[model samples]
Target: MKIAFYGSSLVSSYWNGAATYYRGILHALARRGYDITFYEPDAFDRQQHRDIDAPDWCRSVVYPATEEGLRGVLAEAGGADIVVKANGVGVFDRELLEGVVARARPGALRLFWDVDAAATLDEMRADALHPVLAALPDLEMVLTYGGGPPVVGAYEGFGAAACVPVYNALDPATHHPVPADDRFACDLAFLGNRLPDREARVEEFFLRPAASLSDRRFLIGGNGWETKAMPANVRHRGHVYTAEHNAFNASPLAVLNVARDSMAHVGFSPATRVFEAAGAAACLITDAWEGIEQFLKPDDEVLVARDGQDVADHLAALTPERAKAIGEAALRRVLAEHTYELRGAQVDALFKAAMAERRVAA
Candidate 1:
């Protein structure tokens, strides 16, 4: 099967949080005999900040961020077995969505892959005329990186023929434990690009704890926090490259996963960082959110925090031995139940079933 994936930069994680998810899932699909061509627009300086060169597993096309470039890619995608217009491509998104639905070869599956389903759903709910809502009826299926049952129900309500939540998972090959790096050493570390929807939560969950725990070192690695004021103990390392993520996750005594306001409210959405930290066998602390127990056992495989005080409390009691124990348990659980290989098999089955249903209908 051939897949034409139009998304934000697959070669860069600069301002694109979905890079890891894209790489993991697409790589797994490639191993399962799907030929993938990832089309990413040359926008947001992501081309200059690329974390990885194009991989042999998939052909990556960096198209100009222009109407002409989009038309070229849409024409090229006509032959694919599956045409995917992922959310937040950063340019010509609506055109790409409508293009794949209208121009994909007859019988080619048209998919809308939403890496940020919670935010997308919020937008759809606010505006009935959202372009995605208009495109849903024509799309074969809606695939989401997170946002479990709520997202599926919302999409179905919006007239999507089918909606499936393909949660983020560990790619052991890319994100397993590595020897800790001194550069990222910290008591608690968080790596997320500063964004409006997430900034307040980061302040509440990460910064507040840093202020309260004056003795414990904290590290923040992401773009846009360089100018933000932070406590003397907190170090802001702007834009840690994906190549160094394993070290970043491993060097920290505990890594924190703070969902965006929308994701937390939506309940079941887990950020890519959660799996990345667990994949590196790092003790993970996540802000309280519904459905986490379905992924990691709280206080055993992971620590759940209700607020900044909860985060501080966890650190206050954390011991090297206990952290190691929790991390190991997380690793075991993810390796057995939440790996990209397993996710790939699930995706393959979904694709097969959907194709069969389409054939029957035809």
Candidate 2:
């Protein structure tokens, strides 16, 4: 199958959090004999901050952030067996959503892949005329990276033919345990780009705990936190590149996964960092969200925290032995059952089944 994926940068994680998810799933699909051409706009300086060269698994096309550039990609999309317009392309999103569906060759499956389904659903609920809501019926299926059953129900309620949640999973080859690096060593470290919906939660789940445990070392790695106020005990490492992520996870005594407000409220949404940290065998401390046990067992493989105090308590009582034990357990579980190869197979099957259903209907 030929897949044309329109998304944020495939070569850069600079300001795009979805980069790893795209890489893992698409690479898995490629391994299963799918030919994928990733179309990403040359915007937000992501091109300059390329994390990996055009991957061998997929052909990458970086188009200008212009109307003409978008039209060119849409023209090429017509040749794909599956045309996917992912959320948050950072440019021409509305046009891309409508265009992929309209320009996709007859009988080609049109999929809208949402990396942030909770936020997208909120937008659709707030505005009846939201582009995605308008585009739902035209799409063959809505695939999400998170927001399991709730997201599926919401999309179906909005008239989508089908909605499948393809949760984030480890790409073991890319994210497995590595030797700890001094640069990322800390008691607790968090890696997330600061954004409006997530900043408050970051303050609660990360900064507050850093202040409460002033004696403990804390590190924050991601873009847009350079100017954010932090406790004296906290260190800010601006924009840790993808190459350093494994070391960043391994070096930290414990890594944190803080979901955005919408995700937490909607529940069942585990950010990509959860799997990445687990893949590196880092003891993960995640904010309370429903359906976490579906991914990692709490109090055994993972530690669940409801607030800053819970985080502080966890850190206060955690010994090096216990942290290591928990991390190892989580790693074992993800490697056994939560790998991208498994996710890729699920996706491949879904595509085949959807195609078969379409054929029968025709």
Candidate 3:
């Protein structure tokens, strides 16, 4: 099978949260004998500041951020077995979705994969006439990162023929335990691009905790955070690149996962950081979110916190042996059931089932 995916930069995680998802899933699909081509706009300086070299498994195209560029890519995607327009593509997504669904081969599966389903659904609900809702009936299927049952039901309610939640998972080859590095060593570490939806949660879950734990070291990674005033005990390091993830994860005594307000409310949504931290065998701490227990057993495989006090308490109570045991358990859980290979196979099965049903309907 040949697949065409349009998304945020596949080569750079710079300000692109979906980069890991794209890279891991596409690489896995390619390994499963599916030919893959990725199309990303050259906007956001992502191409110039790429963090990873081009993968050998797929063709990566950096196109002009214009209408002509969109048309050209859509044309190239004509005969693909699957054509995907993912959310957060950093372009006019409604326009891209329309073009791809309209131009893709009749037998091809035209999918709108929403890596940020919560935000997308919120927009759709805010306006009944949103372009995505208008276009939903035409697409073959819809997929999401972590929206779970609520997200899938919302998309289906919006007139989608089929909607599925394809959660994020770890790539053992890219994100596994590694030797710790001194630079990232800290009592707690948090990594995420600063965005409005997540800023408040970061303040509540990360910054506040740092303030309370003045004796402990807190390291913050990702862009747009350097300007913010933080506790004296906290260190803000701008834009930790993908290549440095293992070291960053290993360096921290315990890693933190703070979900954006949208994702937190939706529940069952685990961000890439959650799996990345687990893959590194870092004692994991996350703010409370529903459906978290389904992924990792709370208080056993992972620690859950509802506020700054909860986080501070977890940090204060953690001992070396207990932390190590928790990290090991989380790593085992992810490696066994939450790897990219498993996710890729699930997506392939969904595509096959959707296509087969389409055939029978025809």
Compose the digit string of candidate 1's lDDT tens values, residues 225-314. 988989999999999999999999999899999999989998888788999999999999999999998899998999999999999999
User: What is the full ranking by TM-score, best candidate first?
Assistant: 2, 1, 3
TM-score of each: 0.99, 0.99, 0.98
Superposed by TM-score, candidate 2 places the C-alpha of residue 112 at a distance from the truth, in angstroms, of 0.4
Query: CA lDDT of each candidate?
Result: 0.93, 0.94, 0.90
lDDT of 2 by residue, 147-167 (tens): 988899999999999999998
Q: lDDT by residue for model 3 over 1-362, one digit each (tens)?
A: 89999888899999898888888888888988999999998898888779888899999988899999988888887879999989888787778888887888888888899999999999999998887888787798888898888998889888888888888999989898999999999999999999999999999889998998889999999999988999999999898898899889887889999999999999999999999989989899999999997789999999999998899999999998999999999999999999999999998899889889879988
Determine the backbone clash count of candidate 2: 0
Q: lDDT score, residue 222, model 2?
A: 92
TM-score, structure 3 vs. true:
0.98
Better of 1 and 3 by TM-score: 1
Off by over 4 Å in 2: none
> Scored by Cα lDDT, where does model 2 land?
0.94
- All candidates: CA RMSD (Å): 0.9, 0.8, 1.0
